[model samples]
Target: MPSMTEPKLISGNANPTLARSIARRMTMHRGINTNLVDARVERFNDQEIFVEVYENVRGEDMFVIQPTSNPANDNLMELLIMADALRRSSAARVTAVIPYFGYARQDRRTKARTPITAKLVANMMVEAGIERVLTLDLHAAQIQGFFDIPVDNLYASPVFALDIRHAFAGRLDEVMVVSPDVGGVARARDLAQRIGVPLSIVDKRREKPGEIAEMTVIGDVTDKVCIIVDDICDTAGTLCKAAETLMNAGAKEVHSYITHGVLSGPAVGRITNSVMKSLVISDSIEPTAAVRDAPNIRIVPTAPMFAQAILNIWNGTSVSSLFDAETLGPIYEGMYSSQ
Candidate 1:
């Protein structure tokens, strides 16, 4: 429903496949014919970023698709420069369609003398002439408040719900939704409510930012099919530990559904050796070679939901219906509710 008169699509080097898929769904024309200029960024001898945009976007409502995933700093700078360039070209509005918004985990100051990098990223977007933001499942939902412009924080749980329902049709009564850590209890609870299952939480302690100390599960997972729901899975420590804990607690099967797969360091190997049956992740962050090669790692597409959201936003309609449990079709409601 984007205004056919002045809409334009642009993308950076990051996740061009997703951008192209979104463009295809929007135009129904096998992707829009927008140019993707090579942002030849380099260090200025002093290790500073230099960016340049090669396309003209005058009077257009431009949507720049860029995921700040791996090499996040470079991708973030590229997106900022694209926004700035579009604004300079007299674009009507610039939308930063970042599937993965980096620095979101640092939304607040958990310790003394730590900078709130998420707020800093928001400020940079504002300064770079970004009129709006479209991101999927930020680590901290509060990060949406950092932006001055309207931000759409999309959820991947609904999509996951559909797949889960289809994959585990008659086994709903044996399913249990779990949070990998205590802090993610709210997210898991929301998913469990929508899926109509019992909710459980993994009581975990983090000794360091990228380290997991101990994991103790709170709810009864005995002989139950467990599904761990989390916003992001980086390093895979927390997820692996939680899976191990659930198995130790007598879980019959363990599956993980993470929004962003930031699989870093030994994540793939850890998941390979862990007790999790499958690790389902969204296409918000581009999959790595290791993730693609892992037999247990499965990917669910978010393009349909994102495309529908773009349609809703363009037509100035309500997007709240997307999160409603009833509207997600009867197959999911019956399957998940019984579980």
Candidate 2:
């Protein structure tokens, strides 16, 4: 149950469609007009970001739905500025509903003179008057420690698992999960255990940050329907390469479910001409024209999940159970217990 004070939903340019979908879901649950709040989030002549709230938000719980993707800096500024505006306007509480948290990949300092941008972003959010954060599928789970306020990090696996389950329903035994790199083994293993399948890893060496080396399949994938699970797919080189390696190692089909589809550079082009069967991404970062036009790409809706999460956070309820295998309604069915 939502609180008596209905929350205000605001949107930035990063992902307006997702924001609107979330608002629509909120209205469906609350039975009220919970559309996006009237606000002006625009840029100035000098490319300065400015946010002006048109409607009254005094003492109302505010939600800023912004995903810092593509043009990360501008979108990030919009979130900070919006939070500042809401705080200045005397909002009761401000929660940042960021579906795709950018700069999360830089959670740690891998080398000297490198900055932990993830922590910096967290600090910036708090300094801008954001009281809490609600985001999905962060690149690094440990980044939550960087935030001073409450951070609810949701997983997109449940949404993805439902579709995966349907695709492999009676043929679940032939399926196997694979993590393209060592970093995603936990994510892959979770899904593997969920659907009762084996796990595989793609062991590859990297010469540099943007350069990938030859990959080797760490586990057997003979005659298996391999499901590659990952967080972000920026250039998608690793994704496509891993799919090829898996197929070469005798995988019947290779399907990837990535949480955030950054899809920069020639990502869509590579995916379009890759050996992978399909690449299913969530509606986290607003789909670009290339993404929408991709032949083998699919999108799964996560607005309802986010809307229910917002409602739970507002009501001070358990947010973890929403991803729980046994508790998440008929979507999980009988699988997802070990995870």
Candidate 3:
């Protein structure tokens, strides 16, 4: 018999490894009887998704862990259907835990007649009975406004900062954090501030999708190890181009810390051939085989942080405090290094 005080964790197929990790961490950290609710999520012959919850969730707090990653539409529909199933099954509440919120890049309209798909997705979730959202490093922070329900946007900076600290190891001055674009300056600056390093920005022009019109380094990177920070690395065109630009401007080496590794298409090949020394990404999205096989790519698990946040939410604690870089307190002490 499951206790009513414990939250039931459910997962869709989007990123099963991360979901299971979060459940395990919840058990280990909270000392609560955490259970991963078994559910059947499959496809019908017509390519429609079917979801059925196998356990009773009536009046129990329920959480659905599903990242809208590759096959974005299908995965998204699965989340919606699962949320709907939980709501209809009389679950007290359904909090959608989407580590990598897909379509977040389209948070706003870049051109005339364009759609704000991020808002649309938010509305869809709310309509599907999602009472809350837990996501990591949204491409645009303002996307939180799209949801009327509480949305907790988590960061992977602390995890990256720990690894960078170990990698630099008392030579942090030689490192310069570089934002791949002007928009990411804040994100890069946060990491730089945490590591006590200088910050730079990459000024780039994009004439079309998956293409870089021009790229120029905006700050001094001469002989400095540059680390480019961004939220996603979809095709790796911008990252590869920015790395080349940094090297041309006299950077000693270039690395990247991206939150979501949506490395679709030739992203792995591009990063492998680029001037970048390494590309570190959080396992927000389940990595594809190419991402796993790439020589320069490294993955850091985000489940521990997420598990803590879930516990905090259930306990009515402050979730934003988790973003404090200093408070993370050596959780990765000897376990992480810049590979």
Clashing pairs in 3: none
Q: Report RMSD for candidate 3.
A: 2.4
- Which is better, 1 or 2, measured by lDDT? 2
lDDT of 2 by residue, 133-240 (tens): 999999989999999899999988777777787777787889999999998999988888777789999998998877886799998999999999999999998999
* Preferred candidate (TM-score higher): 1 or 2: 2
lDDT of each: 0.81, 0.89, 0.89
Give the per-residue lDDT of model 1 (tens digit) for 19-128.
77777666552254533343454458876666565556667777888999988988898889878878887888888888999998888888899999999999999999
Models 1 onward score TM values of: 0.89, 0.95, 0.95
Model 3 lDDT vs. the true structure?
0.89
Name the lDDT value of residue 311 in candidate 2.
Answer: 85
Superpose all Cα atoms of candidate 1 onto the true structure and report the RMSD in Å to 1 decimal: 3.7
RMSD of each: 3.7, 2.9, 2.4
Q: After superposition, how far is residue 117 of candidate 3 from its true place, in Å?
A: 1.0
Q: Evaluate model 1: give its lDDT.
A: 0.81
